[model samples]
Target: MSKKQEQVLCIDRKTLPASWVTQRTVLSMDFPTFAATCTKAKCSFVRRGIAEEDRQKKQIIPYILLQTADGGMTAAYNRQGNEKRLHDLWSIGIGGHINPEDSAIGTDSFESILKKGMQRELDEELARRVAGDPIEFIGIISEDITPVGSVHMGAVFLIRTQDPEGYLPGDELRSFTWHATQKLSQLNLELWSELSLELINSLNPTL
Candidate 1:
């Protein structure tokens, strides 16, 4: 059988410019409106390999940060078998690229497409672990200094779970564990996760 073509969303950074994106790494509260405005400009889907070559294109990354009922957060270590760039880095959020398949669900609204894509990713990555929990839009993330960061921007979500203890490490992760937000300093966090922790603390001072 032929290899399945992987398609992902791509938008020219120039065509859909966001001043905040290039200026900083994370924009916790102001990101949603900015991201929505950019997505409405010019966004399309192309093969993942092709998209990777286009530095001018910004690929969307929907990240879900799991907030456990016990007031701790869960993180996963990317296994070597995962994408080389992400291997060994600890990720506090779970997410992936927004693909062409996501837009096919219902393209009438851009927000709908994004939400569907995130839900699809959640189902594929976390399975029934977060089945009925409410997910909320938290913010956006960007890191233009790195090669991968140059072509991607993150849309983050926050979801509270009653039993995050049931979530197991599988797929691209070597292991998954829950930790107090205060203990993040002792862990090796991915760049995005580090920014996420900052945002979480800013919003929830008690954490």
Candidate 2:
């Protein structure tokens, strides 16, 4: 199928209360309830093209942040990436639209299916064999001010890589650059990355 024709998942805006996705990048305490909303999301099926254009719907995406055991991250410049809005920008996360085929693992739960899709994205986007288990769900991100962010809600996840040198970029990403907190602000970050930087900076030894 074509990229635009791909069937993806989304939640109804009316069903997803405005309060659920705030200016805040992270969701805690009510995270379980927030995630449960995705599992209970109605009208989950929609074409990528239509979904991208529909602000009334929030495309549920798993934005996986690849980190080393020591908290270093694998980031890349995205000049040849799929999303044009993020062209020539830097990103710390690797993820894509969740499709119906994600359920091939025979899982009924949305979170399980979401994880499967996330792994598929990693396998497709990166050259190395990153560990699939023990991934952490950090938080959700939304940038209502931007057109691209207004339509989708990112379910942020963190997966660890053994070594930064072990991971390689796919077609969209040129090379994987290892970065620590001190070096992040030097690059032009995409919307999610900008938010991710803030989230990471705000952390104090947790998440």
Candidate 3:
């Protein structure tokens, strides 16, 4: 929504020197290793859509999947935003880009920057609904086959909330609600959300 470009961090594949090596194991890659190998910069502003293809730029997305202890998970319908293309689609992940503000948090490690960014995004999207909950770092999610997935990489997190009741809708969401594990499969979900749901189901079989 801000017309001013959001200076988000990105890894420009073209800028990496031949001496630097990047592994295919992105999911298992730690943030320190990612930042060390790739050419990082606050260059990829949002909505520069096809620029990613031209520049071979990969944007980082901190995707947070929230769940309560009692097999209840939170999901929302996508609404107006930079990702308005996904409007009406259901998603279990809450996240966005790592902006320049994130860097101000700490540069001690790339992991720390991502953590701060994820927390900021969660707060903005969820209105601090799960502020007191514990968030765990999960693996990454990457799919280069699709145009959207081609330019984006997901750094996934799982947040466990103490409240098992339910959640209220936030500004960015058309609606938010808690669903039982058995009912999750019935709803139509976004492509990335399907993967996220599978991951959650695998970790918590009861859910």
Candidate 1 off by > 4 Å: 1-5, 30-35, 79-81
TM-score for predicted model 1 compared with the true structure: 0.86
Per-residue lDDT tens digits of candidate 3, residues 1-207?
452344666666556443221332134344455555543543334444343554377677898877776557565465455675566777778888887678774444566677788989877876547446677765666665566676666777877777744455568866677766567767777777776766566666666
TM-score (C-alpha, index-matched) for candidate 2: 0.86
Instruction: Sort by lDDT, best first.
Output: 2, 1, 3
Residue 186 lDDT in candidate 3 = 77
TM-score of each: 0.86, 0.86, 0.75
Model 1 worst lDDT run, 10 consecutive residues: 74-83
In candidate 1, what are the lDDT values of residues 93-202, reduced to their tens digit? 78788776676754545676678888887777763574677788877778777776777878888888887865665565567667776787778777888878777777
Which lDDT value does model 2 have at 161? 61
Off by more than 4 A, model 3: 1-4, 13-55, 105-108, 164-167, 205-207
Model 1 pairs whose backbones collide: none
Model 2 — which ten-residue stretch has the worst lDDT? 22-31
The superposed Cα distance between candidate 3 and the true structure at residue 23, in angstroms, equals: 15
